[model samples]
Target chain A: MAKYAGYQSSINKAVFIYSPEQLDYKFSDTHPFNQKRLELTIDLLTSINALNPSNIVKPRNTTEEELLLGHDIRYINAVKMAGHGKLTEKQGEPFGIGTEDTPIFPNMHEASAKIVGATLTACDYVMQGLSEHALNLGGGLHHGFKGRASGFCIYNDSTVAIKYMQKKYNARVLYIDTDAHHGDGVQWSFYDEPNVCTVSIHETGRYLFPGTGTITERGSGKGYGTSFNFPIDAFTEDESFLEVYTTALREITDHFKPDVILSQNGADAHYLDPLTHLYGTMNIYKEIPKLAHELAHKYCDGKWVAVGGGGYDIWRVVPRAWSFIWMEMTDQALPTGNLPKAWLDKWQKESPVTLIPTWTDPENLYDPIPRKTEITEKNQQILEKALLPIRSKNSELI
Target chain B: MLIEEIMKTKIFTLKSDNTIKDALRIMRANKIRHLPIVNDENNLVGLLTERDLKNALPSPLVKKTVENIYEQNLEKLMITNPIVCHPLDFVEETALIFYENRIGCLPVVSGGKLVGIVTTNDLLYTYIEITGATRPSSQIEIRVNDQAGTLHDVTKVFTKHHASILSVLVYPDSQHEEKRILSIRVKVMNPLPIIDDLRKEGFDVLWPNMPGINRL
Candidate 1:
């Protein structure tokens, strides 16, 4: 917990963008992409006395025009029709609705639009100088595409928010996705735009979903060298994961010199998560936000908007991991020792698996990854290749 | 996919009597390495490559007068009757030809004339597309016995999940002689359900294979 020291004094102001309606962005009870994680995380922050009602802001419903910023009108219409039970399976197939990952539910368009608007609200708060930072635990649907949906995402909130910031505030955005899967939607949306830079560090596509995040996927046209990806090997531990993340973020921030920072905090890299195969523990969660907090203040005047993405282990992983983001955003001292008894008692009854009773993961979370040395070396090579252009530029300057 | 689907119809070509300087100018302007030579009837006669032009040029260290080097006709340097392909040929077969012959480009001939050209670059792009890396999807690899109907048995799980299969490639397992690996790219982000179904069907899935840990 001492690692979070010195981040408090630099904070100017922070706000939390949330609303009960955001929970409407649910696919089903059995779906892994559950919104219950949001409620649980908010409760954990509340129980710890880190988040106050006054610091919370209600999110607005995104207008069709705003949704059109990153989505096709036809696709939006199809989503609306599917929500109202008017579109058939065949009709919704092309739009990525009526699928197992992103099935149609009641008012799907409105629910998805609200999530998009929540991220936009976070961005507006930070961009308009109302707050130095904002957190939207309901957003970060990074896999939603311009014409269709993939993964469990319907409307891409991060992409829409970036486009909004570019048009309204005319600010250059640097998007950092620390998810297990590749941030393909947001990366492709800004692939050709010079002002918006996207960096995603995830499990390699060799076995991961949405397989496109390789070291060679830099960028195209004017945006060449703007996009960066660091796909580490599966079963990568905390040290190797954080090494690539921290080094790449520092170099990319300095090279791009963005006006603001947008981070997609997907907590599925934990060992408890059932979706992906990254062997990360709770240590990476603490370090992930610490770097973002320090770099945002140093580079973008503390203008940062944080959003949630994919995390399947709702009870044990998502709540603790997401609360750390809000705590880091508001410059609060990190929590240590045991979890709050009241919070644990309430969630333990509902959680099928026994809840972890500490702020940090226990030792020996998983068997020692057998190929730790080889995985670490391969990740280092990837990091070097990704940062080659910027390193060369720095050498030339010297 | 057919060869015509990936071949480039907008070609940079030269005539039989064209000077070496003309070939050099076309290559440089277009940033191309190969050029097809044609006759008066617009029929394929020969092929000129940058390698051929490099061999024909005089050495830079030579002080002797060599103005005639650039004026030499390309017919003297071009390879007559180079390997050519037809438009209807399968792209996979064309790839085999490229691999076996160790060539970079193939001129597509139809009706006794050159219609298009397929370079190594185009074939590589086709491979990328076939793997579905250009789209957003997850890849799953399954190890199964090299017996009959293994593919049919494995694909049933994907059909149960209604997950669209973007690409399916069957390759021999190097370590095991009797086992084969089915590399499938499906158009979905969450592949857990399908992976579970595969495991339940007694198929060994080698997803994210940890080097020393043998989970299978």
Candidate 2:
């Protein structure tokens, strides 16, 4: 725990940073990375009475100066021009706009900036000691690059927010990403920064987009041992996913000893996620934020900021998965059994697929994977190999 | 790719008159194993390697050290007539040369001047790129009959999806003589739609395959 743990009366447990403006960062009607997820998640939270006016804080638009901390000026300008239908395909191609993955949409710049600003707003509340933690459902654009956008992400909110925390509070920030894809943008942003350690556990890039985040990609130069990646095998089920996630997060937090924890809580590893092959279920979601909250209290004096990332199957998967993050944040008893009747009743018409109807996924979501044992052994080996450096270093200290 | 494209252009050289110690220091500083011994006109004269340096010096097993071995001229230990390749040679050709000669690198020469060097690591990286493993893409393997237009049929599915094809590698299938395995990498997060189209086209999708498990 931090020395500031003694402050009790002034700091709130957590603040929910969001606004409807965040829903405008859409690519198209059928794009996979949807901001409607933000609405569905907020609606579920509100139905359960987890959200209120006191806890809800609207997001602001991050300035060009703030966006530049994690983006190139030219790329930022290109996004701005592309947002207003001014940039051509040829010109926007260099900036990773006007493509099938991230096609240009009107007000793209304003939408992306608002997401960055929401994350920054979350950071300020936490770092200013006004809130112990914050959640920005529109943030966690992890694949957005410094000079280009890829994988449907525009401006990387996590990277920009980490930079903001460093510059504003001069604090050592630890970023934890649970997205199905690599958090390449934020990982590369601080690949050589010793103070800002990043830990990402995602599906192996063997067949995933942004084929990076291998176990060998430790930080380089003076920042060696700061970056940790656990690229688990595809079709990895809930048991194996939680094993690697909890073990790696515990080891990395102990090794880095950061002052704050910024977690990118992408809900795309579920079995229903159309983009990824990980076979995670609602169990992982409940535990993901639960552990993040515990570790923040243990190491950071509860200074944790959570952000949303890739989660397709918006109807059945995202709402229930994302609600756990807020429920965990406010110290609500983790819900199980049937979901609120009104919440599911309101959104079932909007959802294309039949909703799961319960707080948890049904038993035996899929047929048992034939190679579960081998996959578990392989993932366990990956965890050991990824932690070898820190383990050896700690042993040397002893 | 040509040797000129992938080869390291910065040549680290040692003269024939330079001492073995100078060769060793250059190798140690650059973290290189092979040193191109050159002349005043920048022509490749010989090749000196760390193995040769190790062979010349006294072994650690022996208590007495041969201190003066470091002072010996590099020409005595270097291979005076090392095989070289032209800049225009294909990387595959150079790879064959290294394999046939059992060497680790090739000295790329043009117009009687040592222009660059190609190491095993460089060739290996080219192979990785050829497999399209370096890019942010997903690979799908298809078993196709080794007939003309078979590749065209398989490629049309990706094109229909507007999925950028990074690289395609064709290899022989061990099970069937007339069949070939086509490994293709495409830049898309959700390849499910593309895979469905390929199956509908009657192409055998061998990968992203979970045979017994149910899929949505």
Candidate 3:
């Protein structure tokens, strides 16, 4: 039966984290990353009537000590002083505050801390069972390490929320990332821990930036084999991605029995993204969240948190792709064809000159050959080799 | 700008044969105000606005049986031949029709097929929402060359000016296949000073609110 999942009684559960303070944390003028992304996303959703006012959740400013929950105290102090326009002796460079990638914008600590707070709030809603799903579209800074920053990310919000979950609820968490770039900081922060299962699939570090998430770097000490990485070839298409992702995710969820699932829904994996070589389409991107929604219902009782990360082709791709994701999370009726003309015109007027794609699903995009059958065979070997049976075999935190 | 550029493509419509009661129910279910009435072949026949349904009440003679009265005059009341446009119609023409007609919506028809629809409210709302016209600030436009470092430098000026960028447009320039001319619109007070700052920094800035620059 071709199922048309008619509009379900949607529970409003989206969090939009905006602060005038975040206007400070910009890298460069020409870079694709900016506060404009959030503004455009919010506008696009609102213009399409996707952002229901009742469902819109705004952000709160996180305190200094609250930031110290997952980050070092010294790092927190460095961020605070940097926000006051006072660069340390090395230009506040050591703390990754005043760098070209992570420029020390005014109110740096407050802005970055709120990102942590936003993700933590989403986690709280799910853990508290306030909603079936939670989203922090503004809070997927997975590139930030515990001590320093890298890859345009300041503090790792995912790690902060994971620690909050572990400490506050004593919950076992599973973190999954399909960003074209590896979630290095998130992996390393939980590398030696057994309770957290970190799985990242990206272009092998051999070719991309921040070269980590190697096949061999499966956790250490008591957390051996808990971390999984599949650094596939550049331009790895969607079919292979779905195959590997679904298999690995299912095996880990079945084995670890996590209480919650956190996923980084990065759009950089699209073929058009200039930053990465992956050729994932919105079709493939939409499926991941839909499947995750189901898995959350089956396994975690619908406790899922999704965060937006990377996508450079802003006009042509990012807005539509992320809107698809948000629609899936909210279980709203999906709009067909390119964005509404009213929206496209407004988007073009605001951002004229860029080619505004007219179709929701780009009709002329390249389709990846179906390789699920072949990929599933390889994925099983990877899963067995990477996911150690330590969780079920020994209940103690060995 | 073609009608395809400004019309709403995603819309819900009803057939002429569908009962007013059923149509009303569908409209209520979808939270929609207008329903395009189509024939069996899906040709636009008429429209049924919420007001139309509401006005079709029972008279004092039939007040004793409201349900029966509603059943009697269901299909007899729908407004036929509502204003519409073809997908190829110019957006300016549609805007004029909307202004002169003072109607909220116009369905898009091509070869008598319902392609899409546009509402005056949608256009007005889009304008206000995107331009940030409601924010009480002048709009400044900067003509940027299609280059890696150009946009970075230009936006940096806005960042320094302490003016929030309301919206930006990367006008698709056919001249430079390698680079695209990006025209950014930022909302701020006194754009001349920032434009001068940009000029000093060797950037091509267009201050629309200035004497020579037209608002278009």
For candidate 1, lDDT tens digit of each residue in A158-246? 99999999999999999999999999999999998999999999999887888889989889999999999999988889999999999
Residues B52-145, candidate 2, lDDT per residue (tens digit)? 8889988889999778888989878999898999889998878998998899877888998899999999999888677645656777778899
Q: Which stretches of candidate 3 lie over 4 Å from their true place?
A: A1-24, A366-398, B1-216
User: Could you tell me every candidate's TM-score relative to the true structure?
Assistant: 0.93, 0.89, 0.59
- Across A166-276, the per-residue lDDT of candidate 2 in tens digits comes to 999999999999999999889999999999999999998877877889988999998889999999998999999999999999989998999999999899999988888
Docking class of 3: incorrect
Give the Cα error of residue B176 in candidate 3, in Å. 33
**Candidate maximizing DockQ:** 1
Those runs of model 1 whose alpha carbons end farther than 4 Å from true positions after fitting are A1-12, A396-398, B58-68
For model 2 the local lDDT of residue A41 reads: 85
For candidate 3, lDDT tens digit of each residue in B1-216?
A: 677877777878877667767877888898877888777787888878888787776555664755764444345777777888888888777788989987778888989988888877677766645543332233444566666788788888877855555466576545446546454444332254466788899865543222322322
The TM-score that candidate 2 achieves is 0.89
Question: Candidate 3 residues A1-398, lDDT tens each?
Answer: 00123464333344444444445446567655665666666677888888755565565666665666668888877877888877653656566655445666667777778778778878877788666677877777888877787667888889888988898899898998988878887888899999998989876553355556667778899998678887765555677778778877787777778889998977788877766656677767777888888788899878898887777777767787777777888778766766677777777876734645554446557544344344445544555555555444655645
Best by TM-score: 1
- Cα deviation at B201, candidate 1, in Å, is 2.1
| DockQ of all predictions against the true structure, Cα-based | 0.70, 0.45, 0.01
Superposition error at A228 for model 3 (Å): 0.9
**Predicted structure with the largest lDDT when compared to the true one:** 1
